[model samples]
Target: MSTVPKRFEILLVSEHVEDRGGASVEDSAVRSAVVEATGRHGASGYPIYEGHGIVADIDPETRTVEALLVDGRELDYGLTALVRTAARG
Candidate 1:
């Protein structure tokens, strides 16, 4: 018998600050990439946005996941870490 894959939700929040000069990432592209990466992990991913970051509710059983891929690199940090990193960059 085969086990059913679990479903997860991924939320990406991005806030556009005036000082940032309206700089922002392409949301649609990111969503598509996340969906594809999640599929590869034998799980379904749903991408959501709030302000200027990402929120993901993943299975604890999942050991690894490509949270975000940008500029030929992959970010595997949690929502909080990702947010902090983005703030610094």
Candidate 2:
């Protein structure tokens, strides 16, 4: 996979969130928060393009959040940084 992948997964971890402590790694609260935070028109503080978008899917079973980017325009440095930051979170 390239540095920036069209499809990437972000592990749901406590470092990415405020609170932690659950019987299972697939905590419902964290999964829901990640989904909403990375979803369309979300509050992740990331830029939203008019024609392009990134779809975030949460899999509680895997305790992971995946983002599939649909870029209509050319991928640039800023977008790459954005993905990197999102992946970090």
Best by lDDT: 1
**Candidate 1 local lDDT, 7-74, one digit each (tens):** 33343333333353454533322332122113333223533222223333233344233344333344
* Candidate 2 lowest-lDDT run of ten: 76-85
Tell me the deviation in Å of residue 72 in model 2: 5.8
**Tens-digit lDDT string for candidate 2 (1-89):** 41222233332223343444444434322221112232333243332222124344333234233333433333232222122123344
TM-score, per-candidate, Cα-based: 0.21, 0.19
Model 1 C-alpha RMSD vs. true structure (Å) is 11.7
Pairs that collide in candidate 2 are: none
Over 4 Å off, model 1: 1-5, 15-66, 70-89
Whole-model Cα lDDT of every candidate shown, in order: 0.31, 0.31
How displaced is residue 46 in candidate 2, in Å?
23
